[model samples]
Target: MARLIDLSIDSDQVIQHLKHEVKLKTVYQSILCKQIIEKASQERGITVEPEEVQAEADQFRYDHKLESASQTLEWLEDNLLTPDDWEAGIYDQLLKKKLADSLFGKQIEAYFAQSKVQYEQAVLYRILVPYSALAQEIFYQVEEEEISFFEAAHLYNIDEYRRLACGFEGKVSRWQLKPDVAAYVFGAHPREVIGPIQSGHDFELLMVEEFIPAELTNDVRQQISSQLFDEWLESELNHLVYSQ
Candidate 1:
Protein backbone atom coordinates (compact mmCIF):
# COMPACT_ATOMS: atom_id res chain seq x y z
CA MET A 1 0.00 0.00 0.00
CA ALA A 2 1.24 3.54 -0.78
CA ARG A 3 2.07 5.68 2.30
CA LEU A 4 -0.26 8.75 2.58
CA ILE A 5 1.62 12.07 2.85
CA ASP A 6 0.25 14.55 5.48
CA LEU A 7 0.35 17.58 3.13
CA SER A 8 -2.76 19.37 4.29
CA ILE A 9 -2.77 22.97 5.58
CA ASP A 10 -1.85 23.71 9.26
CA SER A 11 -4.56 22.48 11.65
CA ASP A 12 -4.66 25.80 13.59
CA GLN A 13 -5.17 27.86 10.40
CA VAL A 14 -7.86 25.47 9.19
CA ILE A 15 -9.68 25.73 12.52
CA GLN A 16 -9.48 29.57 12.44
CA HIS A 17 -10.87 29.64 8.88
CA LEU A 18 -13.70 27.32 9.91
CA LYS A 19 -14.57 29.57 12.85
CA HIS A 20 -14.52 32.67 10.61
CA GLU A 21 -16.68 30.92 8.01
CA VAL A 22 -19.20 29.94 10.70
CA LYS A 23 -19.47 33.55 11.80
CA LEU A 24 -19.98 34.73 8.23
CA LYS A 25 -22.61 32.04 7.61
CA THR A 26 -24.49 33.10 10.77
CA VAL A 27 -24.79 36.62 9.34
CA TYR A 28 -25.96 35.22 5.98
CA GLN A 29 -28.57 32.99 7.71
CA SER A 30 -29.96 36.01 9.56
CA ILE A 31 -30.50 37.63 6.15
CA LEU A 32 -31.99 34.39 4.83
CA CYS A 33 -34.53 34.20 7.68
CA LYS A 34 -36.75 36.23 5.36
CA GLN A 35 -36.32 33.57 2.62
CA ILE A 36 -37.27 30.85 5.12
CA ILE A 37 -40.41 32.83 5.97
CA GLU A 38 -41.31 33.27 2.26
CA LYS A 39 -40.83 29.55 1.69
CA ALA A 40 -42.96 28.64 4.71
CA SER A 41 -45.65 31.09 3.63
CA GLN A 42 -45.81 29.54 0.14
CA GLU A 43 -45.82 26.03 1.61
CA ARG A 44 -48.89 26.96 3.66
CA GLY A 45 -50.77 27.82 0.40
CA ILE A 46 -50.98 31.51 1.28
CA THR A 47 -50.92 32.73 -2.34
CA VAL A 48 -53.06 35.55 -3.80
CA GLU A 49 -52.85 36.92 -0.26
CA PRO A 50 -52.86 40.59 -1.27
CA GLU A 51 -55.34 41.39 1.52
CA GLU A 52 -53.04 40.29 4.33
CA VAL A 53 -50.03 41.86 2.68
CA GLN A 54 -52.04 45.02 2.03
CA ALA A 55 -53.21 45.17 5.64
CA GLU A 56 -49.59 44.96 6.73
CA ALA A 57 -48.54 47.41 4.04
CA ASP A 58 -51.40 49.72 5.00
CA GLN A 59 -50.35 49.73 8.63
CA PHE A 60 -46.83 50.54 7.60
CA ARG A 61 -48.14 53.30 5.32
CA TYR A 62 -50.36 54.77 8.04
CA ASP A 63 -47.59 54.62 10.60
CA HIS A 64 -45.22 56.31 8.18
CA LYS A 65 -47.94 58.20 6.22
CA LEU A 66 -46.62 56.95 2.91
CA GLU A 67 -48.92 57.57 -0.08
CA SER A 68 -48.97 54.06 -1.59
CA ALA A 69 -47.44 50.58 -1.59
CA SER A 70 -45.61 51.45 -4.82
CA GLN A 71 -44.04 54.40 -3.03
CA THR A 72 -43.06 52.03 -0.22
CA LEU A 73 -41.71 49.61 -2.81
CA GLU A 74 -39.70 52.40 -4.42
CA TRP A 75 -38.20 53.32 -1.06
CA LEU A 76 -37.32 49.67 -0.42
CA GLU A 77 -35.80 49.42 -3.91
CA ASP A 78 -33.62 52.41 -3.15
CA ASN A 79 -32.49 50.57 -0.06
CA LEU A 80 -31.72 47.38 -2.08
CA LEU A 81 -34.93 45.41 -1.46
CA THR A 82 -37.92 44.28 -3.52
CA PRO A 83 -41.61 44.31 -2.46
CA ASP A 84 -41.40 40.55 -1.99
CA ASP A 85 -38.36 41.01 0.28
CA TRP A 86 -40.37 43.39 2.46
CA GLU A 87 -43.21 40.85 2.64
CA ALA A 88 -40.73 38.13 3.48
CA GLY A 89 -39.27 40.30 6.25
CA ILE A 90 -42.71 40.82 7.77
CA TYR A 91 -43.53 37.10 7.48
CA ASP A 92 -40.22 36.18 9.14
CA GLN A 93 -40.95 38.48 12.09
CA LEU A 94 -44.44 36.99 12.51
CA LEU A 95 -43.15 33.43 12.35
CA LYS A 96 -40.44 34.11 14.95
CA LYS A 97 -43.05 35.61 17.29
CA LYS A 98 -45.24 32.51 16.82
CA LEU A 99 -42.29 30.25 17.55
CA ALA A 100 -41.45 32.19 20.70
CA ASP A 101 -45.08 31.97 21.81
CA SER A 102 -45.29 28.23 21.17
CA LEU A 103 -41.98 27.34 22.82
CA PHE A 104 -42.20 29.44 25.96
CA GLY A 105 -45.87 30.27 26.55
CA LYS A 106 -46.12 28.14 29.72
CA GLN A 107 -42.67 29.15 30.93
CA ILE A 108 -43.71 32.80 30.54
CA GLU A 109 -46.78 32.18 32.75
CA ALA A 110 -44.58 30.65 35.46
CA TYR A 111 -42.11 33.52 35.19
CA PHE A 112 -44.90 36.02 35.89
CA ALA A 113 -45.57 34.32 39.22
CA GLN A 114 -41.90 34.35 40.26
CA SER A 115 -41.01 37.86 39.07
CA LYS A 116 -43.94 39.95 40.29
CA VAL A 117 -41.77 42.50 42.12
CA GLN A 118 -40.17 43.70 38.89
CA TYR A 119 -43.40 45.03 37.40
CA GLU A 120 -44.39 48.05 39.53
CA GLN A 121 -44.60 51.73 38.46
CA ALA A 122 -43.91 54.99 40.23
CA VAL A 123 -44.83 58.65 39.64
CA LEU A 124 -41.91 60.97 38.96
CA TYR A 125 -41.08 64.61 38.10
CA ARG A 126 -37.92 65.98 36.49
CA ILE A 127 -36.34 69.27 35.43
CA LEU A 128 -33.42 69.50 33.04
CA VAL A 129 -32.18 73.05 33.15
CA PRO A 130 -29.14 74.39 31.39
CA TYR A 131 -26.10 74.26 33.67
CA SER A 132 -25.83 78.01 33.54
CA ALA A 133 -26.52 81.04 35.73
CA LEU A 134 -30.27 80.71 34.96
CA ALA A 135 -30.29 77.08 36.14
CA GLN A 136 -28.41 77.90 39.35
CA GLU A 137 -30.86 80.73 39.98
CA ILE A 138 -33.85 78.43 39.43
CA PHE A 139 -32.31 75.76 41.69
CA TYR A 140 -31.86 78.26 44.53
CA GLN A 141 -35.38 79.61 44.14
CA VAL A 142 -36.84 76.07 44.35
CA GLU A 143 -34.54 75.25 47.26
CA GLU A 144 -35.82 78.25 49.22
CA GLU A 145 -39.44 77.69 48.01
CA GLU A 146 -39.13 81.21 46.66
CA ILE A 147 -40.68 79.83 43.47
CA SER A 148 -42.80 76.73 42.86
CA PHE A 149 -41.11 73.86 40.98
CA PHE A 150 -43.54 74.38 38.12
CA GLU A 151 -43.00 78.13 37.99
CA ALA A 152 -39.21 77.86 37.98
CA ALA A 153 -39.17 75.02 35.46
CA HIS A 154 -41.51 76.93 33.14
CA LEU A 155 -39.33 79.99 33.23
CA TYR A 156 -35.84 78.45 33.11
CA ASN A 157 -35.67 74.80 31.94
CA ILE A 158 -34.04 74.25 28.52
CA ASP A 159 -36.43 71.62 27.18
CA GLU A 160 -39.42 73.63 25.94
CA TYR A 161 -42.17 70.96 26.17
CA ARG A 162 -41.27 69.63 29.62
CA ARG A 163 -41.07 73.22 30.77
CA LEU A 164 -44.63 73.63 29.45
CA ALA A 165 -45.69 70.48 31.29
CA CYS A 166 -43.96 71.69 34.49
CA GLY A 167 -41.33 68.97 34.12
CA PHE A 168 -43.45 65.90 34.75
CA GLU A 169 -41.39 62.75 34.08
CA GLY A 170 -44.66 61.06 35.01
CA LYS A 171 -44.92 57.57 36.46
CA VAL A 172 -41.68 55.67 35.91
CA SER A 173 -40.04 52.66 37.58
CA ARG A 174 -36.61 52.69 39.23
CA TRP A 175 -35.18 50.78 36.26
CA GLN A 176 -36.43 53.50 33.92
CA LEU A 177 -34.29 56.15 35.56
CA LYS A 178 -30.51 56.30 35.31
CA PRO A 179 -28.69 54.31 38.01
CA ASP A 180 -27.67 57.38 40.00
CA VAL A 181 -31.10 58.98 39.59
CA ALA A 182 -32.92 55.74 40.46
CA ALA A 183 -30.81 55.30 43.59
CA TYR A 184 -31.67 58.74 44.89
CA VAL A 185 -35.34 58.73 43.86
CA PHE A 186 -36.33 55.29 45.17
CA GLY A 187 -34.21 55.49 48.33
CA ALA A 188 -35.40 58.95 49.33
CA HIS A 189 -38.60 59.56 51.28
CA PRO A 190 -41.76 59.96 49.23
CA ARG A 191 -42.53 63.46 47.88
CA GLU A 192 -38.98 64.57 48.59
CA VAL A 193 -37.22 66.84 46.07
CA ILE A 194 -33.80 65.54 45.01
CA GLY A 195 -31.03 66.93 42.84
CA PRO A 196 -29.47 69.79 41.03
CA ILE A 197 -27.48 66.73 40.09
CA GLN A 198 -25.66 66.21 36.80
CA SER A 199 -27.05 64.06 34.00
CA GLY A 200 -24.87 64.32 30.91
CA HIS A 201 -24.43 68.07 30.27
CA ASP A 202 -27.54 69.28 32.08
CA PHE A 203 -28.55 69.51 35.72
CA GLU A 204 -31.58 67.38 36.59
CA LEU A 205 -33.92 67.84 39.52
CA LEU A 206 -36.17 64.95 40.42
CA MET A 207 -38.97 64.50 42.89
CA VAL A 208 -40.70 61.27 43.84
CA GLU A 209 -44.20 62.47 43.05
CA GLU A 210 -45.63 59.12 44.14
CA PHE A 211 -44.39 55.62 44.85
CA ILE A 212 -46.11 52.35 43.94
CA PRO A 213 -44.29 49.27 45.10
CA ALA A 214 -44.22 46.34 42.67
CA GLU A 215 -47.69 44.99 41.87
CA LEU A 216 -48.52 42.20 39.48
CA THR A 217 -50.57 43.90 36.79
CA ASN A 218 -51.49 41.49 34.01
CA ASP A 219 -49.78 43.41 31.17
CA VAL A 220 -46.59 44.17 33.10
CA ARG A 221 -46.41 40.64 34.46
CA GLN A 222 -46.80 39.20 30.98
CA GLN A 223 -44.04 41.42 29.61
CA ILE A 224 -41.65 40.44 32.42
CA SER A 225 -42.52 36.79 32.02
CA SER A 226 -41.87 36.91 28.26
CA GLN A 227 -38.49 38.54 28.77
CA LEU A 228 -37.45 36.02 31.40
CA PHE A 229 -38.47 33.08 29.26
CA ASP A 230 -36.63 34.51 26.24
CA GLU A 231 -33.44 34.83 28.30
CA TRP A 232 -33.73 31.29 29.65
CA LEU A 233 -34.48 29.79 26.25
CA GLU A 234 -31.57 31.66 24.65
CA SER A 235 -29.17 30.28 27.26
CA GLU A 236 -30.48 26.71 26.88
CA LEU A 237 -30.27 26.87 23.08
CA ASN A 238 -26.71 28.22 23.23
CA HIS A 239 -25.63 25.46 25.56
CA LEU A 240 -27.14 22.71 23.43
CA VAL A 241 -25.41 23.96 20.30
CA TYR A 242 -22.06 25.31 21.50
CA SER A 243 -21.21 24.02 24.97
CA GLN A 244 -18.07 21.87 25.27
Candidate 2:
Protein backbone atom coordinates (compact mmCIF):
# COMPACT_ATOMS: atom_id res chain seq x y z
CA MET A 1 0.00 0.00 0.00
CA ALA A 2 1.41 3.22 -1.31
CA ARG A 3 -0.48 6.50 -1.23
CA LEU A 4 -0.91 8.54 -4.43
CA ILE A 5 -2.87 11.09 -2.43
CA ASP A 6 -3.82 10.76 1.21
CA LEU A 7 -7.55 10.12 1.56
CA SER A 8 -9.87 9.58 4.49
CA ILE A 9 -13.23 7.87 4.01
CA ASP A 10 -15.61 5.58 5.90
CA SER A 11 -18.59 3.35 5.00
CA ASP A 12 -21.10 5.94 6.32
CA GLN A 13 -19.53 8.76 4.27
CA VAL A 14 -19.59 6.57 1.18
CA ILE A 15 -23.26 5.82 1.72
CA GLN A 16 -24.05 9.51 2.32
CA HIS A 17 -22.18 10.54 -0.83
CA LEU A 18 -23.95 7.87 -2.89
CA LYS A 19 -27.29 9.18 -1.64
CA HIS A 20 -26.32 12.81 -2.31
CA GLU A 21 -25.24 11.89 -5.84
CA VAL A 22 -28.62 10.16 -6.48
CA LYS A 23 -26.76 6.88 -7.09
CA LEU A 24 -27.91 4.85 -4.06
CA LYS A 25 -30.92 3.39 -5.87
CA THR A 26 -28.80 2.52 -8.93
CA VAL A 27 -26.13 0.97 -6.69
CA TYR A 28 -28.77 -1.16 -4.93
CA GLN A 29 -30.23 -2.25 -8.29
CA SER A 30 -26.81 -3.25 -9.66
CA ILE A 31 -25.94 -5.30 -6.52
CA LEU A 32 -29.33 -7.00 -6.66
CA CYS A 33 -28.84 -7.70 -10.37
CA LYS A 34 -25.45 -9.40 -9.71
CA GLN A 35 -27.04 -11.53 -6.96
CA ILE A 36 -29.86 -12.54 -9.28
CA ILE A 37 -27.40 -13.29 -12.09
CA GLU A 38 -25.25 -15.39 -9.76
CA LYS A 39 -28.21 -17.56 -8.70
CA ALA A 40 -29.53 -17.95 -12.26
CA SER A 41 -26.09 -18.82 -13.61
CA GLN A 42 -25.51 -21.43 -10.90
CA GLU A 43 -28.89 -23.02 -11.60
CA ARG A 44 -28.10 -23.28 -15.31
CA GLY A 45 -24.45 -24.31 -14.77
CA ILE A 46 -23.35 -21.31 -16.81
CA THR A 47 -19.77 -20.85 -15.68
CA VAL A 48 -16.70 -19.03 -16.95
CA GLU A 49 -13.66 -21.21 -17.42
CA PRO A 50 -10.39 -19.85 -15.99
CA GLU A 51 -8.81 -19.86 -19.45
CA GLU A 52 -11.60 -17.68 -20.82
CA VAL A 53 -11.13 -15.17 -18.02
CA GLN A 54 -7.38 -15.17 -18.66
CA ALA A 55 -7.93 -14.56 -22.36
CA GLU A 56 -10.26 -11.65 -21.62
CA ALA A 57 -7.82 -10.25 -19.09
CA ASP A 58 -5.03 -10.50 -21.63
CA GLN A 59 -7.14 -8.66 -24.20
CA PHE A 60 -8.02 -6.02 -21.62
CA ARG A 61 -4.38 -5.46 -20.75
CA TYR A 62 -3.42 -5.25 -24.41
CA ASP A 63 -6.26 -2.83 -25.14
CA HIS A 64 -5.09 -0.61 -22.32
CA LYS A 65 -1.44 -1.07 -23.38
CA LEU A 66 -0.39 -2.54 -20.05
CA GLU A 67 2.53 -4.26 -21.80
CA SER A 68 4.28 -5.77 -18.78
CA ALA A 69 3.42 -7.41 -15.48
CA SER A 70 4.62 -4.30 -13.63
CA GLN A 71 2.47 -2.03 -15.79
CA THR A 72 -0.56 -4.27 -15.27
CA LEU A 73 0.04 -4.26 -11.51
CA GLU A 74 0.32 -0.45 -11.55
CA TRP A 75 -2.93 -0.09 -13.50
CA LEU A 76 -4.78 -2.28 -11.01
CA GLU A 77 -3.27 -0.32 -8.14
CA ASP A 78 -4.33 2.99 -9.75
CA ASN A 79 -7.88 1.65 -9.94
CA LEU A 80 -7.65 0.49 -6.30
CA LEU A 81 -8.06 -3.16 -7.34
CA THR A 82 -5.96 -6.11 -6.23
CA PRO A 83 -5.03 -8.86 -8.73
CA ASP A 84 -7.69 -11.09 -7.15
CA ASP A 85 -10.27 -8.31 -7.46
CA TRP A 86 -9.39 -7.83 -11.15
CA GLU A 87 -9.67 -11.57 -11.76
CA ALA A 88 -12.99 -11.69 -9.93
CA GLY A 89 -14.31 -8.73 -11.97
CA ILE A 90 -13.24 -10.47 -15.16
CA TYR A 91 -14.88 -13.69 -13.96
CA ASP A 92 -18.15 -11.88 -13.21
CA GLN A 93 -18.19 -10.26 -16.64
CA LEU A 94 -17.48 -13.57 -18.34
CA LEU A 95 -20.15 -15.33 -16.28
CA LYS A 96 -22.82 -12.76 -17.22
CA LYS A 97 -21.83 -13.05 -20.90
CA LYS A 98 -22.06 -16.82 -20.79
CA LEU A 99 -25.36 -16.65 -18.93
CA ALA A 100 -26.78 -14.19 -21.47
CA ASP A 101 -25.83 -16.40 -24.39
CA SER A 102 -27.03 -19.56 -22.69
CA LEU A 103 -30.41 -18.01 -22.00
CA PHE A 104 -31.00 -16.02 -25.20
CA GLY A 105 -28.60 -17.14 -27.95
CA LYS A 106 -31.02 -19.50 -29.70
CA GLN A 107 -33.93 -17.06 -29.36
CA ILE A 108 -32.21 -14.12 -31.17
CA GLU A 109 -32.94 -15.25 -34.72
CA ALA A 110 -36.66 -15.84 -34.17
CA TYR A 111 -36.96 -12.61 -32.23
CA PHE A 112 -35.14 -10.72 -35.01
CA ALA A 113 -37.37 -12.30 -37.66
CA GLN A 114 -40.46 -11.29 -35.67
CA SER A 115 -39.21 -7.72 -35.31
CA LYS A 116 -37.37 -7.20 -38.61
CA VAL A 117 -38.59 -3.73 -39.46
CA GLN A 118 -37.35 -2.31 -36.17
CA TYR A 119 -33.80 -3.20 -37.21
CA GLU A 120 -33.81 -1.26 -40.47
CA GLN A 121 -31.17 1.46 -40.36
CA ALA A 122 -30.33 4.42 -42.53
CA VAL A 123 -27.21 6.53 -42.89
CA LEU A 124 -28.27 10.10 -43.43
CA TYR A 125 -27.15 13.67 -43.88
CA ARG A 126 -29.32 16.56 -42.87
CA ILE A 127 -29.37 20.34 -42.84
CA LEU A 128 -31.69 21.86 -40.30
CA VAL A 129 -32.43 25.57 -40.59
CA PRO A 130 -34.90 27.92 -38.95
CA TYR A 131 -36.65 28.75 -42.21
CA SER A 132 -38.41 26.59 -44.83
CA ALA A 133 -37.14 28.94 -47.51
CA LEU A 134 -33.54 28.40 -46.44
CA ALA A 135 -34.05 24.61 -46.23
CA GLN A 136 -35.60 24.53 -49.73
CA GLU A 137 -32.75 26.63 -51.07
CA ILE A 138 -30.20 24.26 -49.61
CA PHE A 139 -32.12 21.22 -50.93
CA TYR A 140 -32.04 22.40 -54.55
CA GLN A 141 -28.40 23.35 -54.23
CA VAL A 142 -27.70 19.81 -53.09
CA GLU A 143 -29.95 18.22 -55.79
CA GLU A 144 -28.48 20.32 -58.59
CA GLU A 145 -24.91 19.75 -57.36
CA GLU A 146 -24.15 23.45 -57.22
CA ILE A 147 -22.83 22.72 -53.71
CA SER A 148 -22.35 19.43 -51.84
CA PHE A 149 -24.74 18.33 -49.09
CA PHE A 150 -21.89 18.25 -46.63
CA GLU A 151 -20.86 21.75 -47.63
CA ALA A 152 -24.42 23.03 -47.29
CA ALA A 153 -24.73 21.41 -43.88
CA HIS A 154 -21.47 22.78 -42.55
CA LEU A 155 -22.32 26.23 -43.84
CA TYR A 156 -26.00 26.47 -42.91
CA ASN A 157 -26.94 23.91 -40.24
CA ILE A 158 -28.26 25.53 -37.04
CA ASP A 159 -26.62 23.16 -34.61
CA GLU A 160 -22.93 23.85 -34.07
CA TYR A 161 -22.19 20.15 -33.64
CA ARG A 162 -24.11 19.14 -36.78
CA ARG A 163 -22.47 21.92 -38.75
CA LEU A 164 -19.07 20.51 -37.80
CA ALA A 165 -20.22 16.97 -38.62
CA CYS A 166 -21.67 18.12 -41.97
CA GLY A 167 -24.98 16.84 -40.63
CA PHE A 168 -23.85 13.21 -40.69
CA GLU A 169 -26.25 11.13 -38.59
CA GLY A 170 -24.84 7.63 -38.45
CA LYS A 171 -26.86 4.45 -38.86
CA VAL A 172 -30.12 5.94 -37.62
CA SER A 173 -32.76 3.46 -36.51
CA ARG A 174 -36.38 4.06 -37.59
CA TRP A 175 -37.57 4.64 -34.02
CA GLN A 176 -35.10 7.53 -33.61
CA LEU A 177 -37.11 9.80 -35.86
CA LYS A 178 -40.63 11.23 -35.81
CA PRO A 179 -43.19 9.07 -37.67
CA ASP A 180 -43.82 11.49 -40.56
CA VAL A 181 -40.12 12.33 -40.81
CA ALA A 182 -39.13 8.65 -40.71
CA ALA A 183 -41.53 7.80 -43.50
CA TYR A 184 -39.88 10.35 -45.77
CA VAL A 185 -36.31 9.40 -44.76
CA PHE A 186 -36.75 5.61 -44.92
CA GLY A 187 -38.89 5.47 -48.05
CA ALA A 188 -36.57 7.70 -50.06
CA HIS A 189 -33.86 6.09 -52.17
CA PRO A 190 -30.14 6.55 -51.56
CA ARG A 191 -28.83 10.05 -52.36
CA GLU A 192 -32.43 11.23 -52.61
CA VAL A 193 -33.00 14.50 -50.78
CA ILE A 194 -36.23 14.17 -48.76
CA GLY A 195 -37.23 17.45 -47.21
CA PRO A 196 -37.80 21.04 -46.53
CA ILE A 197 -39.81 19.22 -43.90
CA GLN A 198 -41.56 21.59 -41.49
CA SER A 199 -40.83 20.75 -37.87
CA GLY A 200 -42.07 23.20 -35.27
CA HIS A 201 -40.17 26.47 -35.76
CA ASP A 202 -37.51 24.72 -37.81
CA PHE A 203 -37.31 23.10 -41.22
CA GLU A 204 -35.05 20.22 -42.15
CA LEU A 205 -33.65 18.82 -45.41
CA LEU A 206 -32.61 15.15 -45.35
CA MET A 207 -30.56 12.98 -47.67
CA VAL A 208 -30.20 9.25 -47.36
CA GLU A 209 -26.58 8.11 -47.56
CA GLU A 210 -27.65 4.49 -47.62
CA PHE A 211 -30.36 2.17 -46.38
CA ILE A 212 -29.21 -0.91 -44.50
CA PRO A 213 -32.15 -3.30 -44.79
CA ALA A 214 -32.84 -5.51 -41.81
CA GLU A 215 -30.30 -8.30 -41.57
CA LEU A 216 -28.79 -10.29 -38.74
CA THR A 217 -25.33 -9.02 -37.93
CA ASN A 218 -23.04 -10.24 -35.13
CA ASP A 219 -23.32 -6.83 -33.46
CA VAL A 220 -27.10 -6.98 -33.81
CA ARG A 221 -27.18 -10.45 -32.30
CA GLN A 222 -25.12 -9.29 -29.30
CA GLN A 223 -27.39 -6.26 -28.89
CA ILE A 224 -30.53 -8.37 -28.99
CA SER A 225 -29.05 -10.81 -26.49
CA SER A 226 -28.14 -7.99 -24.11
CA GLN A 227 -31.64 -6.51 -24.54
CA LEU A 228 -33.24 -9.85 -23.73
CA PHE A 229 -30.98 -10.31 -20.71
CA ASP A 230 -31.82 -6.82 -19.41
CA GLU A 231 -35.57 -7.38 -19.84
CA TRP A 232 -35.30 -10.71 -18.03
CA LEU A 233 -33.30 -9.09 -15.23
CA GLU A 234 -35.88 -6.30 -14.88
CA SER A 235 -38.76 -8.79 -14.77
CA GLU A 236 -36.94 -10.93 -12.21
CA LEU A 237 -36.15 -7.93 -10.05
CA ASN A 238 -39.74 -6.75 -10.18
CA HIS A 239 -41.05 -10.17 -9.23
CA LEU A 240 -38.55 -10.43 -6.39
CA VAL A 241 -39.59 -7.05 -5.03
CA TYR A 242 -43.30 -7.81 -5.38
CA SER A 243 -42.87 -11.15 -3.62
CA GLN A 244 -41.01 -9.52 -0.77
Badly placed stretches (over 4 Å) of model 1 are: 1-55, 78-80, 129-140, 159-161, 187-191, 212-222, 229-244
- Per-residue lDDT of 60-132 in model 1, one digit per residue for the tens? 8788777876778767755556678888766555555554455565675566566544445668777887675
How would you encode candidate 2's per-residue C-alpha lDDT over 77-140 as one tens digit per residue? 8887899999999999989999999999999999999988878999988888999888888888
Worst 10 residues of 1 by lDDT: 1-10
Those runs of model 2 whose alpha carbons end farther than 4 Å from true positions after fitting are: 1-4, 128-137, 140-146, 158-162, 175-180, 196-204
Please list all clashing residue pairs in model 1, or write none if there are none.
none
For all candidates in order, the CA lDDT equals 0.66, 0.90
Model 2 TM-score is 0.86
Best by TM-score: 2
Give the lDDT of residue 11 in candidate 2: 73
